[model samples]
Target: MKKTIFTIACILSLNIFNSCSEDIIDLKPPYEEIIEDAIKSEEDVNKFLMGTYLKISSTSLYGSNFFFYGDLLGDTFFRSNKNFGGYTSLIMMNYDPINTGDINFYRSAYDVIQNANFVINNELTDSQLNKQYKAEARFLRAITYFNLLNYYAASPKSGLNQDIGVPIAVYPYNPDEKIARSSISDVYKLIVEDLNYAIENAKAETTSKIYITKTAAKLMLSRVYLTRQQNGDAQLAYNLTDDIINNSPSSFKLFTSTTKDAFKNYFSSSEDIVAENQPETIWELDMNVLNNPGVNSSLSVFYSRTGSKRGLLAKQTFYDSFGTSDVRRDLFSFTSIPVEDNPKGVWMAKHERAAQPGGNYTRNNKILRFSEAYLNRVEALYQLGKNTEALTNLNEFASLRNGSAYSGGNLLNDILSERNKEFFGEGQRFLDLKRYNLPINKGTNCPGNCDVPAGSKYFVFPFSEGQLIINPLAVQHPLW
Candidate 1:
């Protein structure tokens, strides 16, 4: 299986190289033909990793949709009246499996998996650089697998480990061959296996946080375990996040200050978030003027008040949920005068680009951040029955954000609400709602289909019809 996979990977990689050289001028292809010669030195391996990283950041997947998909699916973001340009189907729960090209995240993810497999299956371990390259590939493969499962399958918490996840494609790409989807638990096991290897060995020393590291892998591990919600998984989550929190104290502090402009600075200055100056940023997808998701697909187009679409907005009730003293609420701004004879309830300005419409979208897509590690730990501790410890961590983080500390109440509800506030526009609420299998009580404010009531099929997205046609054994999601 390994030999067959490796041989096919070479072909797939050559095709990837050819597409770049022949069509895309901006991405310079690596020198003269064939696998071994092009990959003779360490420089060759670095080039492949960088190319794969760019591919993963494509707008279809992480570059844009995946982030907001989290918001649109959850209670946080929904289409405002008269604004139906972006994610209307998702917010309205109207997915069409037949509209294959636009909605599917399959190809982009599999492309990365294939590219990463090329690096992994090769005997790239003769030198230190080669081993590091292998580790980097492992990290990317793990990250892709994690997201794939999130979209295609139900969480164990929701489905008791019996849901179908996307196919395991880590071996290699073969157009003739088809691998059936694995159970959610099985896919998670592979994700953990790859991430564990990365946790122990991947340094990612030369690359910026854009590349995954021990800390990033640990954060991912913490999430996976927390979602599983088993006794052992919860403990693992606690241990993993505790190490990241305690060991890297200064390296991962939250943005806090005396003035109300505390969290504002993190988003107000585009440089702070995208340039890696903010301490909270663990791993962020780099976007710049020269290289970015084209203006039409840029993430900025959705969140900015004056963005291209600005289809979604923070609900007034959601806005009122925040305390007056909370610095986080300042991240939003409503058009009180009414753009189309109707005012929108403050689109999230958390993604301000300073020079947005004129410049290419330089808004960095944050993959993992330090603040999440705190939330992950608090959730784990709370689940472990260590309410005191969980509340302490929660209060500490809340205090830093200018919110009142918990004197003593329902920690879980408080934590959930805080997640809604802190991660607004960063995309998190959806999965939590799915994992808990709770109705998306969009309250009285939502304009359409707000109630994602119990046992909703919209919880998981449809596999594209093109995918179903190609892979005969694959099943379409029930909702579609």
Candidate 2:
């Protein structure tokens, strides 16, 4: 299936550049000419922008790395010992310095960033082109950078203050030119600038619910500010998103069905989503078999029998975290054959498609969800000492899935645990732990027993070695 898609993509690429290449030796046309000749038509612009979306949805970006490298690699979700290969090597105590997969993921993410930047910097001149499309593209660029910074760079206050993050390329770069990472602060500033521009200029168009919107920009800003510990800014951003959500209560209702139904509904149905939003999504990587193939490889590899055996499974601790009464446990776990020393009870993440019968791919990748926004608001409010309000909102979300509002401990702890349940398998647990300074347990050794100390520097992923090799100005993390 993937091969078929790749063939089609290559054909399309040939068709897209055939004219320019026939007239000029190199396919690299001036940005102006490409925009004037290739993108002047609405259909042409739409098709070209689809390529940008494909990059974000690619296996290296949201489709697989976002889940495996970002979330499952952390302590919360675990790949049972029997299936521990790439994940255990990359994330668990066994640090394999030569993992090429990590390098590939990084390159893929940067490619998406580059494509987005090209569209934003050069593609928006048509008087007839809707402004919303441009805004959506910009929103995607900001999102791509936000993920890169979080994964590749240290916190704002870390000694690597002036350290560079992945390069913030806004224009196409020559393949031969050595790219250098930009400072974390500079990257963030560019993200903010793009998001701000998107919010202001996006008023002229409307897009599918799966695409980013003005509200999605606000939600992302809220996340960015929270990550930087800029409380005031975080509060303001959340407030803006809250206003948008609250203004149309009828449009956004929590899923109050059975946990399985609730979880499935978020992805398969649109009823639970806000009227203008994609159900279960604040932003998603648009994908289709016809135009996207690289984005499908992650799915192929994840469920491939010949690939890494590290299929989804709850860490023993994560599985134990859920009480028997908690329905989410049932929703996420699945029985899978034990790969090695691990027992038969080994579980895999059931949230995503396990495997397509004999085939290995699945459609589309989900990035942000409205539920995350609700949690962000709840957590921010709890931190701000608005405990009562926070609990109220938290319970509102909980009630939808659990059949009753959560009755738990202190508001802060409850919110934290709720996040674990809400975002399980979504690649957020690791980030949440780092942000809150929590400890990571690196699982067992020989028989598989390891534990990472709480707040240890290892919790933070180091910048890729390739990044440093190319950008001498780049700073490595403390322990690396």
Candidate 3:
């Protein structure tokens, strides 16, 4: 279980892409440290693992763009005219290999994966704590890989191109080595493997939502299975969620209060929950006053009315889709301040302002939550032909949120629509659309070019030209 840590011989060369006209902004590499035998004990592994978590929370990954693109590319939000020209490529669905944000995401994700690989490959100590640290590292790597695959590779169900996926790194990064894109099937294989290992060896959910736990691993793996939809995968996903809802510890269940204040307080709470509270977040990135991603990349910056760079506004159509009785609708409110084109607009209130001087609007990035368990299970049940069970679960979840009861007709669509209402700003829609092979329809909010055809190659983002040049074996996505 021990291995020699090798020194990095060369600095990885990355093309620093920047074009203000194209709305591209440069980002720093996540890690510049040399790997050594520094990680020789459980404490060392713990420290490095924490670094990996910090890297994964970068704006290019989960903290901002990763989640924002999910809603931006989907139908939830549009680029407001009062806005400057930042992130225009994402909203317009026109990006190439040289786009800085895309490149940043690709590189940052790999950087995190490399760190996780370092932890996983080396036996820092033969202690039980070391085993848990490795498990946590594997969980981080799996989630990173899964997110990479979502953008870099076509969905397994997309039927467009499924052969090429992002490169899989299981060992410490070596700059001199050129890596090729693994097959999509192979990439998912490694993700599932890592997650399964974490589920077996990682600690259970306790008082922390910031750390990955067995419940988080199980929830993530269920999502993976739900996405793949291979033989018996729906059943597998359903079983995992069922166990979570019924058998997991009380610290990992939903916030099932039906009151408006309860729903509002849940999203706007600036602090992590203690043991006595009903758990909503299964995994979240810790964002505090001391450690905050400043305005430009902060998730709250886009949604908070006080945010100087507030450019993502809710579409009137989407805003109206909420039922009158639904407490979730209260999450959106009018902003009188005129953006570029619009005189006033509605903004999502899910991310509370950690409002600091100098526009450092910040909030914890909620990555996974318990409500998804119901959504995933409901969809899986419908997919498994258990319509009665699916409706029962769906109604239970909806009633808790004060949404009108859904009786019948087109149950799958109902499930998806419910997900849209429940997770509008949380970055779930884009992939949900892809998995279901649905078109991206912007309705009245379309900026000239509205519909991205079902199974379009645009769904599969292109590999950076720099990556293709550096790793000769690396292939650009087809039709990019």
Query: Which candidate wins on lDDT?
Result: 3
Candidate 2 local accuracy as lDDT? 0.57
Measured over all alpha carbons after superposition, the RMSD of each candidate to the real structure, in angstroms, is: 4.3, 6.6, 6.6
lDDT of 1 by residue, 1-480 (tens): 122422222222322332233222233434224455445556556666766777788887788878778887787666666544756577667776754344657888888887787677664555765776677687788778878777777666766336577788735346688777877778788778888877877773323556667787888889888876765988999999989888863556555674656566666565644345457777787666645776677777767766666566777778888888888878888654135423346677776555744574746777788888889998998889899988998988888777877755877778788877888887688877766667887764455677777566667678877788899676775445
Report the error of model 1 at residue 164, Å: 1.6
Better of 2 and 3 by TM-score: 3
Error of 1 at 230 (Å): 3.5
- Residue 165 displacement in candidate 2 (angstroms): 3.5
| Candidate 2 residue-wise lDDT, 243-299, digit = tens | 656752243334445656545545433232321244445565543333344323554
TM-score of each: 0.88, 0.78, 0.89
Q: What TM-score does structure 1 among the candidates reach?
A: 0.88
Ranking by TM-score: 3, 1, 2
Question: How far does residue 281 in candidate 3 sit from its true spot (Å)?
Answer: 1.3
Worst 10 residues of 2 by lDDT: 1-10
2 or 3, which is superior by lDDT? 3
